[model samples]
Target chain A: MSSTTLDPSRRGAHAGTGGAPAGGMSGTSTGPGPSFFRVLNSEFIKFRTLLSTLILLGCTVLVVVGFGALSAWGTGQFAEAAATDPQAAAAFAAQGGDLAVGVPTSGIAFAQLILGSLGVLLMSSEFTTGMARSTFAAVPKRIPAYAAKLLVVMVTAFVLTAASVYLAGLMALPILDNYNLNLDLASPQSVKMLLVNSLYVAAVAAIGMALGSLIRNSAGGIMSLVGLFFVAPIAFQLIPGDFFVEARKYLPGNTVEPMTAVQHVPDTLEAWQAAMVLGAWVVIPVVLAAVLLKKRDV
Target chain B: MIEARGLTKVYGDKTAVAGVNFTVEAGRVTGFLGPNGAGKSTTMRMIMGLDRPTSGTVTVNGSPFARHAAPLRDVGALLDAKAVHTSRSAYNHLLAMAATHSIPKKRVHDVIEMTGLADVAKKKVGGFSLGMGQRLGIAAALLGDPQTVILDEPVNGLDPEGVVWVRNLVKYLASEGRTVFLSSHLMSEMAVTADHLIVIGRGRIIADAPIQDIITGKGQIRTRVRTDQPDRLMHLLAGDGVSVELQENELLEVTGLDPRRIARAALDSHVMIYELTPLQASLEEAYMELTKDEVEYHSLITTGAAAPVQSGGN
Candidate 1:
């Protein structure tokens, strides 16, 4: 049975000798290992094939759109109440009377959480399922695959966040117009918010992937991501020390607000400083993960 | 060809694989046989460059696996059947692995049909039975049509037909002048499948020789005797360089004694002997004798006292 099933001539006939130059030349001498682009393509295929990853991405879109609509309605209510109360009016005026600009990014927090977990799961599942063996066996250099996965993950998170934020703005447009509120989606502040928030989410996803590679477990990576993005900020605020208060401003999550503000808010980081902080948050862990991935056993 | 020079792996306080050296040549099936927890998988992983060796080097062909220009093209390995994400379909899994080396879509489809995974190619691998998973792994290994094939227990969890299919497939692969290195814990399977054998136990090489030599060599001589006066013959055989074990009412298994010596003693002692047969060691017996002292986790089975079985079970 196996003799009939494994006919080499028949199998070879379909293979078409396309890689003969690489295969035959490399038969005695090495031809081409996994180049960066090939590994990226491989990682992208792996990234898109899993149903769980698609489900998580879908949930991110739903949550972002839902929160955008809800925030628009709440802002409309505040604007309506401003006419009857001086304090409410003052608050509305202080908000620049354009609460609608912030509505599109109202669900950025949830998007970061969901996409960050997705990043963690992507890398951790490789180790958990023993897929690392096959992956590294193909590209034994190891760093190219790790870098390729990181690029795939960060790019997906950025594109998804930016696209979802834009969709949310479109969805919230009519809801804000019902209360006589004007929102210019093309306004510089709105565009700044979208780009900065998207970049911030991409950074978070990179950090999550780094944690995943380092920890090699899904739950642990996700928990560390949550602790860095969610728990640390609240815990730092609750602490009484001045150092904690100052350190909170440098957190990756806090950087997004300062970065997107029309003007620098007092007591917050400068835009350039915030960008550098976020860049550090991303680069440090990613470089560390790549080094360890190359050095350690798969 | 594959070569290892003092390859070793140490984890925490324990050494999973100690310093070991051996070479696997091309154009033949080399079976790596051992009991469970014998570092067969670790050695295979090192050869594929998935695990870093502690203080030694292992090279496939001429250079280390990592140094090859195209690893997947030069060598293919199925280190484990579950070395795949369960949520992905079998087809997608092969496609993704193939993409790493720019393997064509046609080749991907070819491997799927070749491994008989065409029926469930679209289904999630998590839902696959063990046999189906093994087939998927084999398909992935052959995706590049590599020159060297390394499989760690390819017949594991396979049905009888699947087992025979793998046996013939590997032999056919070796016949094509490719290097085929396979691993299994089953001695009977290795007896029929492997041309050369490298037996490992407790992370050490117990025997590295041709399959026939391992079967016939290192086996002691033993003769079985059946006598009416077994007690008298047993006493007569009790001497230096002799051991006797009673099998039944009139049967004795005598070691370190030639059949002629036993018969002469039986006749001189007026002990009527009916059956005196010499026993040639089978592969199973030879393997047991070779690895009896090298087994790492010896099961403690006492007649009256009992102990819990350890975690490492095949």
Candidate 2:
């Protein structure tokens, strides 16, 4: 072995910087190490390249838009019935006669499930397919890659959900017009629904990804996500106890209503309390996942 | 260069790798030869910082792998052929890995071409044959043009031509003063490809030396003898350092004694031997000699069953 060739000073100077001397093809690299930005860029590439992830995103759009049109027609029929029924009319009036505004986000329940599963899949697949080895090898710090992937999953979930919700609203417009019902797309309430619901779904996706990293299996992660967001709430409600009822109100899925509601409904958490609850839901799992990822073997 | 000091890994009660220390220096291809269940892969994973050591430390250059400012540029590894998402195309897999280090598209394409994956680069890795997967792995390992390259079972599922290609590639990398450490269970492959050999078995280091020394050092001297009076010669050659076995009616295989001593014994006994051939021990025999006692899985055979044939001898 050549002593000069093993010189750490010379090698360290060029390592991770990405700035190599001329003819870098000769293995004379001056490349930059895996910075947070670089890892983020890599994660984005991974996110956009998979056909399955793209398909999930497309499904979210279709389901949201399809459910929007259906809900618009359903709301119009109910509004028509309320014209003659006094009790129905009183209930309709209590909603400020703006029930059509809720049509666009009718598919949100399904959106949360699909996008949340997508979140779980992206992280869990790394372990299942052994890709984590390559990923961690490049960024041996491990957490940078985890953070970068989380950013990609959450951002994509937010943008895709928001865009799908907007498209659903647009699709609901003509349907509602045919039924002689009004839906103001630019209304403050409409914008609040769009932004808050989008953010909520993004939070669910983050939680799903955290479960994925922690569980490191697709079915297990998705199942745990469903239990937290779906089954646990229903199960808690059915158990018939004061504690069960109180706990059901704090479920992640239940938090969305309070966050998007203009006024806090009775028996539900206030918007600020709901927001903190949702934040805790996301923060706890994500932090746990990050710590485990850093410590475990790839 | 890579260095390990008392590196160990224990999975529950099973010690996958005991505390073993060794250095893989630059400018040569060092082969890590071991059987299945040995610590080869576990040790390599520790060096890459993928698996935390239960105890001790390993370093690349002068620090832990995770501490390297530019880990990809400093070290690249093909720890497994399947260290990829099968649904992703070869091009995209390499692209994602390159993105971490801010590597250019040109470099990604360069590695693809270098690994002869240009034709299948766009196809999903799920459909790739094992050889193709190995090629893609090599492509990823070389994506950074790293100073140190580590490959585990690199030619595991390759055709003869692919095997030759990998052998030449590792040698070329070493020739350029890069530290090339590769592991394989095939002693013949390591004999020709590696300048130095680190023989491991049952989670322990059995031997570490130059390749040539291993082939010649532990392997005992054996000579093939075809004589008219095989039984008489067997009795004449019976001694502390010599054991004679009747291979056939007229053929006797002798071990532990050189041919000169055998010839002297035969001359004194006046037992004419038609053939006296010295058997040159190949790397395979030397490896078996070193690892025979350390193998983890021993196949049980009945007493009348045929003895295991030792390969790679001339």
Candidate 3:
């Protein structure tokens, strides 16, 4: 290690300020401050630096592709069974004859779970590991950092999910071709499903980040996300009440189905209503988290 | 220069930092000395704008820390040693912080080498020892080469060499006309390092003055005298504000009187005195005298191995 003495030449113009007016150093900084884009770069650096975060992202891709291949094989077997049994033929007719198109996105459930937990961990670990102090100390306005982190989480989630789903579709092509099933990935319905599912996963990841910020604990944030997306839907179904049945349609997880459906299924929300409800789910928690994060001590 | 005016912080019902005012001037090392839980960390947090003051303001240079165009360039602080993500490597942690202010990569490498973390800069912080963590914290604090530097217990977990390095570093920063505000509970460290001292206790500023003044201000001048006629000397030294305690058979500790006065009195009284040594109070005693009443938790003094018998049974 070098000696602690600083090189005098490297000492900026602020050095030798003993003759300067007392308390006149306020606006002396000529260096760049934390602009939004700079803070966004910082947040991106933080997001990609963790090994655990990268592992979780890799797991999301693996689960999506693995489920896609399995779903394609299962759909081929069912299509072949439909030719032999009248009962199987009736079930096949009920399934819209385009089962292969949905095969790529069959792992949307697991993708949401993994990516959402990742979102929670990213924000929660900041507080848990005491990194918020350094983070806010750099950009004291604080909201920029929050917004930057949110943008990073959402954009990464959307892009990763989209790419993974498309890759899964490519992988499923040969398997589906064995059953003579025509699955066109470039079809409008397939594109809609990919785009909507990617956006849904992005929204869920954002909600997870909001929960992480609000709760500031990894386990608590992930549990609350799971409860909102998984348990609440099942509980609402088993309760057997009109309010819960109605409430189930507005659940953030439930909205993905209505918005991604080929047609407006009976007793489900319209695409616009489900879109609005999902938007509310993301906006309310995000705004609350940002405001509280700004107001609270690091 | 960092200035705090009527700064206060209340957590729920307890006030962590009560209304206090002090200015840390440039070109000197100002030591913030206090016992644990005496509001040193809370006050520093207020100055950093990490914690909002309940009813007052603290400004770095001339404005609040958050209002600076480039806060890192104007002021750098080591609020906590662990104020970093443990899972990240030290280099990446500093890289992320440096990116916020557009600090160049060369400066990041400079701070790393300066702080003796070049060997472990790529290692994950979670596996680092406390000393390594402290070194990393100091590296981050100096990353900005700020005009004002605030470090809370910078040498808490450092080795002797590291401690000496920090001492010289702060002094060097001050020599270049930068403001260096350091906090430590160790009065001995403050005595050797700080040019000025601001002593706080129980969320209050108990003393603020030059380091030498604090060492000799609150404590009385004591003279240890050994004489053949202890009783006579004690009798002769009895006066207003003068106390003479007979520590042993012929040794007497005289307080509130200088050695010259005691010798004069002994010479005039015709009493022989062999030894008279004037005792200068150390900063540790001075600090204990200042914060004696303000210590929140007092450790019980164990006199000996003998147990006291209880008079009443429960």
Candidate 4:
């Protein structure tokens, strides 16, 4: 079943069971050589093959669901206490007893940390393990490979986070029902929370990738990512100043609340403003990293 | 064909490869010979477009490697055997590389088989022995069936059988009109595998000549002449740049002259010559001579900042 000769350009004694000779099919004819599609395919293969990647993916799902069930039981107990105690009821009112909407995404902060670390590991491992030479060799148009990897990471983060959130919501329904608590999965606020948190996790993953590219060492990249999303906000708060207070708005983790609100929340960015700020958080570092990666030797 | 015009690389204050020019014609194995820090890998990296040159340019088949429509098809390079993700299986590593050029899975399998990695193809590369890792690197290089192949120390950690396989494979590839350029410090390996030699030292090319020419030019081909009239024969054969060393009572080792001249001198003078034996120079000694001052061939002093390796000649 060899030597069918699809294009007359590559006619020779075939080297395999198919028509394509060993050296028959050369480079693609024209139009987007290392196209996004091709690079994406390559990146996907790289992503799925590693045991560490699969382990991280599995951890993301388990944490989201496990935390969701825990939050559900905790919320039910709090609701029961509010009924018996007046002071507890007042505190619950002050906090706005709308805690159910966020229960499904209770583990999102942890999810972001884990999934973001996965993103950092993926890109940094390539350099630390010396895989960049093979990667860059295939796609010398370096940006395409970077873009494809970013696309893969962000999309995986979005899909996995969203699905896990939904599954967590479903699991919580049964647990919350035991305490006669009502949780509407179809509620507008609930849907908004799931979508916004998923998008937030995806953006965090992209930022992680940018850090990995900028710093090719895995420990350095993950530490930088954690420093940006985890440490910076707390550090800013601990330092008492108007500048630190104002600068905290620009931090990537804080943007999720402003963009996910039911109404324009005071002392927080507007929805559109938060969206733009989050976009900048992902784009600015990613672009800088990409430019440096292209210019520097592997 | 691969051509470099003043291909240079400088890392901060130290230059790894200086401005030098050479062309590797197709259909032969060009052995890049040098000691460590001789810029063989740096030059190969620049040629593959992984490292940008500080000055000058190199082209494969009349265009810079990055500019080629399909760079992998034009040239394949294994700069380092560690140039792989350890977490991935050997099969998947090749598969990921193959996917970039739309190379099929069948070709990947064929390359795996060709490199004798079929057994460990499914295992994680992190767990592989050094020999297995080298096979995987070779497999990745051959995935595209490239015209110009560059393998840096391809046999560095191979078993003897694996070494023979690679030697035969590169020679076979060269015979089919592909340009196969490889680098090694083993002069014995280079002597047999290369048709041409490009010797580099301290970021500069020392000699660029055919294999035979290098062995002849830098290496002396001497003759052992056994005769009762050794002194007369030695005097008769003596000329400018020629040296005659008496090994035994009757044996004389003649340099800067060949067997034909010695036979002619003996016939003309009517000296009774019992034996005229030609002694071929080993490539190891020749390589040492070629890189004498250009690269430090350290003496066997026990001071040992780094032990000076006495290769096969030891």
Top model number, DockQ: 3
Cα misplacement distance, residue B150 of candidate 4 (Å) = 0.8
Candidate 3 clashing pairs, residues 3+ apart or interchain = none
TM-score for each prediction? 0.84, 0.84, 0.87, 0.85
Q: List the pairs of residues colliding in candidate 2.
A: A16-A31, A16-A32, A16-A33, A17-A31, A17-A32, A18-A30, A18-A31, A18-A32, A19-A30
Q: Estimate, for each residue in B105-167, the C-alpha lDDT of model 2 and write its tens digit.
A: 888888898889999999999999999999999999988878889999999899999999999
- Docking band of candidate 4: acceptable
lDDT of each residue in A168-254, candidate 4, tens digit only? 999999888887787898988888899999999999999999999989989999999889988999999999999999999989999
Model 2, runs deviating above 4 Å: A1-29, A96-98, B218-309
- B7 Cα displacement, candidate 2 (Å): 0.7
For model 2, residues A1-298, the per-residue Cα lDDT tens digits are 2221323444444333322221232333466889999999999999989999999999999999999989998888788777889888888788736578889999999999999999999999999999999999999999999999999988888999899999999999998898789999899999999999999999999999999999999999999999998899889978988999898888889998888787778999999999999999999999999999999988
| Model 2 residue A4 distance off true place after TM-score fit, in angstroms | 21
Ten consecutive residues with minimal summed lDDT in candidate 3 chain A? A1-10
Candidate 1 local lDDT, residue A65: 94
Question: Which residues of candidate 4, in runs, are more than 4 Å off?
Answer: A1-33, B218-286, B289-314
Residues B1-314, candidate 3: write the lDDT tens digits.
88899999999999988899999988889999987788999999989999999989999888999999888888889989979999999999999999998888888899999999999999999999888888888888888778789999999889999999999999888877888999997777887899999988778887788887666643367889999999999999999988999999999999888788999999999999999987765345555554455434233212312111111100
The i-RMS of candidate 2 is 8.6
lDDT of 3 by residue, A1-298 (tens): 2212256655535466654655666675757889999999999999889999899999999999999999999999999999898999999989937698899999999999999999899999999999999999999999999999999999999999999999999999999999989889999999999999999999999999999999999999999999999999999999987999898888999998889888989999999999999999999999999999999988
Q: Quantify how close model 3 is to the true structure by its C-alpha RMSD in Å.
A: 6.6
Per-residue lDDT of candidate 1, residues B1-314 (tens digit): 78889999988877878999998877678999987778899999999988898879998877899988878877889889978999999989988888887777887888898889989999999999989989999998887777788999999889999999999988878776667899997777887899999988788887788887666543244789998888889899998778899999988998777788889998887888999998764344545554455434333322212121111111
Query: Model 3, B20: alpha-carbon shift in Å?
Result: 1.0
What's every prediction's RMSD, in angstroms?
7.4, 7.1, 6.6, 6.4
Candidate 3 displacement at residue A75 in angstroms: 1.0
